[model samples]
Target: MLILWTQGDTNGIGSEVILKSFHRWRHRPHRAVVVGSYCMMKFYEKRLNLTTPLVEIESLNDIPMQEKTPDEPLYVLSLSCNIKANVGEIQADAGELSMKAVERAATLCLSGEADAMVTAPIHKEAIAKAGYPFQGHTDFLEHLSQSGRAQMLLCDIETNLKVALATVHIPLGKVSETLRASGLRPHLTALANALTKNFGIQTPRLAVLGLNPHASDNGVIGKEETEFLQPELALLKQDFCVDGLFAADGFFGAKRYKEFDAVLALYHDQGLIPFKMLAFETGVNMTTGLPIVRTSPDHGTAFDIAGKGIANEASFLSATHLAIQVAERRRHLETTA
Candidate 1:
């Protein structure tokens, strides 16, 4: 049984993708129980004309992992807040529900009932406007998991390229301050461990990116690379296959990126702008260093296209598949070890 705790509502692409993906997976040997609002899901269900029944389950034990029929396990866990989810408009009530769904999903995972979690794209601004102090799903989940070392890893299956961010969701001005000598080692260590454990890469070849243009041109532009990044890279090389302090300008050239399994970016835009450009529709955003696996679409809520039935679900679907892959691999290692 695989408990898929979907957070985003039907107004966005989350429920649509979950339903579509469920239709694709229903015939297979798995159980997908949705953790969301019943009314909101019904709204999308009618829109998509979905055939799968939305059974409401109170406990994880209610999931019937072995069955095939209309009677088979299909369900929803409804929440209190309700609003007419305008297809393209962001609403505080919708954002509140989204956050609650995530909170509940984390509870399920921590309680050992769910094997893994696949979250839908969330609108951070909407969430904040709702009075919730949230940066993004990764930060929210890290605190929910009570982990100090959580990291974000991006992978596109088609490209077989994985990139992890050392610092995320911060302004360009603050990235260098965040990438201190004390904190640098833990992010890199987490990246290496997650690459090996989740993606099955042993001795993962990691390329670390520089913070400034031309990698500071040997300290002509900035000193972060030589002062902080290089020493950390040197320390990590003793036990790991790691290299870099490569200039951000030329690091993405064909010859450089192809040689490494993953690139470690100094900050958000330094990494994501290029990543999204290259792997926009196929990327999977994974949260590493958590006890349980969690992944989400590399994209965010398509507010303009929300409720239009036109938002692309490819990224969200990719994230779902990646979550399953990593969880199954981890489960296998646990079984064999």
Candidate 2:
């Protein structure tokens, strides 16, 4: 598969991690091309003192129509940014460049020019400063792909733990109202389909966490669980092998996530806190329910460690592997169908 990897914030660790990950993937079978500023990548290449040769390409067509060999240099479809790298500061130009790369990569995937996409981390604040109104990559991708609703799925291959968020990039106070407004059915359906189609699970068992404390402490803490979750879960169970209303604290505290194929959390931190605790170094964030496959490292652009040359690329590598695996599975399903 030909993967289009985006260069995220130029001032952050995106370039560092991408270069590091490429250095480690020299023997991998899949072909990948970077879509960002050639100068930025070159800067990181020199800073890191790595000899992974970079071959600049004017467009995706410039890539040779063959699997990249171990001896081959990394191909880069360089975009023009014309900004110097500022190691640890957020710059509007950096944000613009990052989003531009994402736009190009997503367009390629939608056009079938690229099999899948592995995005490096983009700084949210910088993007906002750049005048784009996207909450994050998920919503931006949803708009770009025109996918009805995109879901965030976090996975740890080592522990086989997967968590999908019902509401993302929203305030804690608004999660309840948002859930009430949109309901949980769509998210559940998306999660189920993603597990079956992308992860190759046959008859996946799904679990959902409660909205309130102790699932509303049996209606003592809050009414969201009693009034909203229970009824929705009952209907969802008819269509899915799903169980829910589990207390987030004890459910994960007692390691209940392992019993199911995937767990669905009501909000972001509820799912991410535990998942990050378990697999921070190797977590992969996947954007599901999109027309094209997309995944990124679970962590963000670590500004403090941007130019230190100590940034770990484990999560990015895992994201790359998962993107390739999901893309291949999708290809198989398409051919067989």
Candidate 3:
């Protein structure tokens, strides 16, 4: 249950959310550690007036392999980033710091030093400026884990909603072509696998949303559903209980989303906008089809609210809880299998 929490951008609310999360817990519930700048955490501790048992360690070897105490405190990996402690402004150094922390933490998970990972939000612009040019945490994780075809799954336990995106962090103009070129099979496969394994759904049924209005009205609006999706749907139906390139707005508006185990949205905004609308402060972002378990808060860096001591930690806390559950389930499944 050694969860490594990566400190995201120093310019945003990553550190604050993390600290605030620990503060909200009456008693520590998970064995978690941080993999980020020690100085930055200290600065936030002062600014946010939050305190936790922070055991700063140079490496994983410093930790004892035993059950953690209820008040075991949050251990930090303690990498020096020379953080400026500047809140609410993006910087190249903060970007580098965030990337370094994530890469190091992911390395631990890949190497079996950690059981699961909960990443704080990282700024795409800052990370790009720092020379780690990737779309976001998901892409960076794909590279680090060498896990091909990573899928982004967002969930809200309270709302009982799960959305898996086909294409993330891409322009709206390119979404159609991207989904068309990639085909729906991979997205379908990944979503189905995660639902079965992580969520323990024996026969998960999924709702597939269209890339066009009215699901293209049988090719009147767009051919993506007929030309690309139909063929794959024909093949996937043999193994999965999936149906529809349902029209997005109507499906969500009618609350048909609740009828399925999950929904597949063709693009980032398509999936996230509705998901966030329903569960803005409680959703968790999970990456499936990876060698290691990874989950994150649904929100971004939140620079506008950084250092205000008012950023909600519920989403980040939910992410941590889900990571622990998924990790345990994964281990149990491996043993049982």
Candidate 4:
């Protein structure tokens, strides 16, 4: 079974994308179980007018090992929070439900009941206001798994480009310090391994981006690029197809980015700005180095237009598809080896 945990409140587009992805992909052999409030889901079903039925399951054992008939392709393990969410409005109750959904998803993934997990966008401010110490979904999941570091990779299969960030969710002032040798190599290694093992990229070509303007103009603008990044790149190239310290400005040019399989960004915006520009609606945010596979949409919770019923689900749908593909690939490698 593939358990998909959605951050709560059906009033938002999360509910819309959850049902949309399930409806579109339910023909697969695996069953998708939603971990969220039953009432919230039902509200979404009525609002979106989707015909799919959501079943409430007590446990993973309640699901049949195999479907006797081919008609039922999906199931929902509805864990009800029973909270009323005001459409397009942020509230404490909604925040609580979102956190619960995240917690449930992490626990299920850890327990081996779910093959892979896909998370919907959650309101970070709402979550923090509710007293959760999480920086975001990736940080929360990494903390839950007790993993060393979680590498964030944005992939667009159409272009065969996978961009991973060395520093995420941090202020710009700290980006240079964060790009030091102790910080960069581990994530580079993690992304390289994930590409080979899960995505079947045998020799992944990696391009590392420069931190400052024009890669610090060869150390005239900043010395961190030459001091920290160049050394790390040299060490990484020993084991992988790692190349860069390329100037961030020119790296995203049409010719340069297409030359490599993946581009390593120094900071969040340094990479995401170009990434979004290229594949805003088609990208997938995949977390590497996790014990269990996890992916989310490249976008975040659009609180400004939360419940207007106009949020696009393209990124979320792409993320779901990527998670399933990676999970199936991992399963295949395990079975064959």
Q: Output the number of the lDDT-best candidate.
A: 2
User: In candidate 2, what residue range of length 10 has the lowest lDDT sum?
Assistant: 60-69
- Please write out the lDDT profile of model 1 over residues 53-102, one tens digit for every residue: 77776666765655655446467766653567677567777788888888
Clashing pairs in 4: none
Off by over 4 Å in 2: none
Output the TM-score of candidate 3.
0.95
Better candidate by lDDT, 1 or 2: 2
lDDT of each: 0.78, 0.91, 0.88, 0.77
- In candidate 3, which residue pairs clash? none
Instruction: Name the lDDT of candidate 4.
Output: 0.77
CA RMSD of all predictions: 2.2, 1.1, 1.6, 2.2
Q: Please, what are the lDDT tens digits per residue for candidate 4 over residues 1-337?
A: 4657565544457887777777666676666677777777777777767766777676777777765334663455666656786776767667767877777888888887788888887777677877888878889889989988788999986666688988889889877666663556787788888888778889988888888888887789889877777776787788888887888777777458888878888889988988888888888889988888898888776666765557777887787778889988888998999
**Worst ten-residue run, lDDT, model 1?**
65-74
Instruction: Name model 3 segments beyond 4 Å from true.
Output: 64-66
- Candidate 3 on 24-109: residue-level lDDT in tens? 65366557788998788888898878876677899988888777666666778988856797798989889999999989999999
